[model samples]
Target: MVLAFSTESLNGLCSDDQLELLDAIDHLRLQGIDHYISLPQIIVCGDQSSGKSSVLEAISGVPFPVKSNLCTCFPTELVLRRTPETGVTVSIVPDSSYNSTENGLHKFHEELDGFEGFPDLVEKAKVAMGITTLGKAFSKDRLRVEITGPDRPHLTIIDMPGLIHSETKTQSKTDVRLVRQVVRSYMKQPRSIILAVVSAKNDFANQAVLNFAREVDERGSRTMGVITKPDCLVEGSGSEKAFISLARNNQVNFDLGWHVLKNLDSETQKGSSLLNQRNVEEARFFSRGAWKELPPSMLGINELRKRLSDVLLKQIAFELPSLIREIESGLDESREKLKELGEPRRTYDEQRLQLLQVSQGFQSLVEGSVSGSYDDPFFEDAQSDKGYEQRIRSVIQNMNKEFADEITAHGHRREVGSKSQTPDQNPEYVTREVFLDHVQSMMQRTRGQELPGIFSPLVVADLFRQQSSPWEEIARGHVKKAWDSAVKFLELVIEHVADPSISNSLLEKVIRPALKTLLTDAEVKTAELLKSHHRVHPITYNQEYAETIHFPGSHSREEISNIVRSFFGLSSISNGNQYLNNNNYNLSRLVDNLSKRVEPTTERLAASEALDRMLAYYYIALKRFIDGIAIEVIEQKILVPLSDILSPVAVFKMPAKVADLIAGESWESRSKRQDLTKKIDVLREGLGTCERFVSSRLKDEQNSQQEEAAGEDLDTSDLSVGIPTASDTEEAGVV
Candidate 1:
């Protein structure tokens, strides 16, 4: 299975320095770095039965089984390495979709001294992947074959299952979708170079792989077109000329350009020495046909090997800096996850210490929120819903403002007059005349042995109690709102500081009961504040009460006299002088006139005065109630108690058994920690590999510059000579 090309020619395809670069990346891939970060490699994709396997065989000298039907069912990675001895190591890298115990796929491995067992090895891999006996038509598992020989080119090429157009009985629609998904996944890797293979025997426009390649590599910068089976076309025919045009990079131009490879036909599949014979036939067919018009470097497998090697090397060099950064970022993420999972807590003392640490962190955050000292990163985005919820003081302040507005707007049972700026549209509003009539009736019913112009204090107290009835409900609601906010903020803090298992237990056992008790106290305090206004008589020491009581408008003497006469049913008396003459007025007559005259006037005056006093006292008490509820119930009872509910001191006071019950690690937590530790170790190793590669690359560049300065001219035309440095890559606008 040796290649037709000589050892010297193969060595010239890629330099030792370039091979070392590929080796570094390949080493990381073998370590499973690809699961975390995409690496630079070449992926060969084509439509079914497009001679894709034949092209791969001609290039790598591995005898891929070529048949009339589809041959490859899964992706195969060919890792070609240059070594003094020839050997092959085949292993199955299980897909992340499957567990290690799935059909024992993870245990599949084999070694051989040559390529004779490769086909048999592939069959064994399919069996291991459950594709042979089980009804599974395709698998995401990759068959990785590391081939080492003196003449092999240093390259890693992945041959994906050929893209299918429709579903047959053997290949269901699920198979078609799975194959497409698998191919797209590899192509979507930003660093992969796509080798899109199409057959000249079929219509080039109908090939699906070209469309897929264009979708992922829009500018064609990373895609190279490979036209196989050029011998299928008739010489000098239109199809031949068309494919010749395509081969010349004119019909379907790619930035990496197109390459023509002639693969073995069906008749040649049964023969020995296929690689040697295939090469000789490919040279003969292209040398005489219209393909001869193209450059020698774009027509054969020999140049293709060199081209692939150079492209892979350049891609690695271009992407190395970013790759290193990605690895470092992944490493940091793994470390942070491990830190969150924390060390294992298997004993009572260990669990207690962990719980105490979590409590201290939670208390620090809660205290910061309650005090409005939001310096932590958790409080960064204050405009988002979660961010606003985390800042307890700000949220409470907003809620308090809303509560005050509600009390001011809706606290009164009656809006007594048109003096209200925005008249109350509610059913409780009553006009001044109507309200005064009701008050006069009430006074009459409750009249005591007071003088005519006096009304009992009990009437005013009854009106005040009814007017202030809405206060208790509004205040109670405000207290409950604040309590709910505090509870939410505490829950968020616990989630941030403790592991899930510990946080859930602590909330159910300790934090929730304390919050409930605090809420009850807040509600009770609010009720007490309202009761003071409800049950007691209206009283205020402020001098504003006197200022607030004044006659609503001027009253003329004629109006008063008419009102008196109408109520007393008396005939008109002489104007002013008759009543003023003391001699003419007898004592009995004067007393009767005086009693009737004051009765009507007394009732009207008493009602007006009562309305004024009730309004004044209502406003004074309204201000006091708003302030008391905001400060005493919400701030003191609910918010201020939040920091102490889960403080370190509380944890210290808890019994050892309680601490163990609340903080014991679950099986899931322990398993996650172990997994994260393993991932962190791998990421650290990956970072080291990337850094060393970059360092060596820099040293090589410096050495090259020094060599050039010493009168040694390097070949500037060579593809390897122009690999962009890190700075050059940035200047070229590579991300």
Candidate 2:
């Protein structure tokens, strides 16, 4: 079937199944059917004169033509199926492989001859098979052999042409063509299975049959191997023993011969034996007309027929389904081949365009990065590929690191996906503790993925690259852009071999995208950090962390400060020696908070408590800063005026529950200063006098008050809210 439609039209006509079949065919061509176990297509094949007939008889246990007459000309299909009464019997018919041809050769195979023709026919068949039937000049009718009866289980055996390799003296083109046509037909069934009949005759070079076999079936592995002529090895001939060594070599060389069966090396089979001296020399063995009275293994004609029939029957059962499948697959493949032959010009153009786009993308990528300059002798080295391979390996290593970090960090380093949550570090130990934690945290971060070292190589190399000399930059731009440009090289490295440390997930997902993202992010973070670098950078740290939290408030401020200096090995910014502020520990609370936050999320719940502790430290420090400032303002500003209006206890009585703590009692140890307390009390009386004075001033200066408020809508409730008492005269103080 030629698929002549445009892609759109083809899409319209194709059901999902057809498209899927097309896809499967495409995949099969690349990987071969080895990817799957196909049902067996057992093709029972042999040459014109080989004992394929007797073999068929023995295995099927049914009478096959015993004569030498070429009766099976066209290919025959014998489907062995089971039924209740018969147990199993083959359903015989001509396959479509025979149907397509109009020649007399179509009816190629016929049951060869009668029992009267047996002895001579068997001898001639042996010779015909000795040389491949391929060179035989026989009339096409001589090639036809009829199908024989074979009982089997869900199997069909396509008993094909006997050994017809090109080396035969009696070979005929018409004979080869007829068999090949049958094979071609078999190929159509998708169920046709081929069996390559190798006689233990000349070592295993009979494998040369496969050269021709491949022309008929691409899946020659699906061909079951039939080691006919197993009797060639006889006790009297010293050469028989030499055949044993040949058998072993055959096993080693052709272990992958077929699909449904392992090749039958006569040497490998149990209970198998070589013929004795008398049988080896005798041209005619004792004769028998039938095999009903024969023993299981042959000493004479009856038993020999029984042996042939039995193995043939078993092999027939094996070959049928595979033969059908092979035929069907070939038919399907031919249809595809026809469609490819008829593909439209526009389709070719579109494919060309797609190819061009891919090529251009590849070219741009290579030119920018991976490809070498004309001057780089390493890239141009003709004598050795070592330099080229090394360059590629280096690019791959760097790429693996780039992608590994991106994935481990979950696409962005700033994101907190793979970090240690509560890293063990003592706040007192400071520098080494924190530094150790950083390294440990980096390692811990590596654990989030299966490949630790391979996936996340230290991209701190990026910083070195950034800080390199200008000449180095120029050199890198020329030689190493492949690693940096990434996507192209990334894809290559991933498909090729890689570091055991690298994860496939990182390559496909992370490294490819991160190179672009990091460049953008670096620019952004740099600009933002420049804005307030002064204020933020000048702050001192309280302390570096030790391996354990030995000083989570375990030590005092002075001790922690000393720890910080000692841990970092920092000298003090001497008081008169120059720094603007005496207080140290100026780093932002957020930075420390983020570092602890960025630690790997511990796997065990036991570490959550430590993370909580780390978070609490940040919260407490920030809280103290705000609370201390708030306390200072309350002591200096609000308490003075409010206290002047009432005694400490009187102030509490003002009745806004919120203000109950607003008096002198709000201060710790307020009683320690009596003068301050006494003044606070006297100020309450003075508040009443000031209220009177303010009222008189307001009465006289009403016009002045109007002038003061003339252009504004500001309310002074806060100003009066703290003033004084409940008398009618006290109204002036409230006002």
Best prediction by TM-score: 1
In terms of lDDT, the poorest run of 10 residues in model 2 is 1-10
TM-scores, one per candidate: 0.66, 0.25
Top lDDT: which candidate number? 1
* Candidate 1, 603-628: lDDT as tens digits: 88788667667777888888889999
Stretches of candidate 2 exceeding 4 Å from the true structure:
1-39, 84-152, 165-171, 180-194, 201-203, 206-208, 213-221, 234-242, 249-252, 255-735
Q: Check candidate 1 and list the clashing pairs.
A: none
Instruction: Single out the weakest 10-residue window by summed lDDT for candidate 1.
Output: 550-559
User: What is the C-alpha lDDT profile of model 2 across 519-592, one tens digit per residue?
Assistant: 34433432333222212322224453342245333323344445555655666423232223575554323223
lDDT of 2 at 160: 55
Q: Model 2 — TM-score against the truth?
A: 0.25
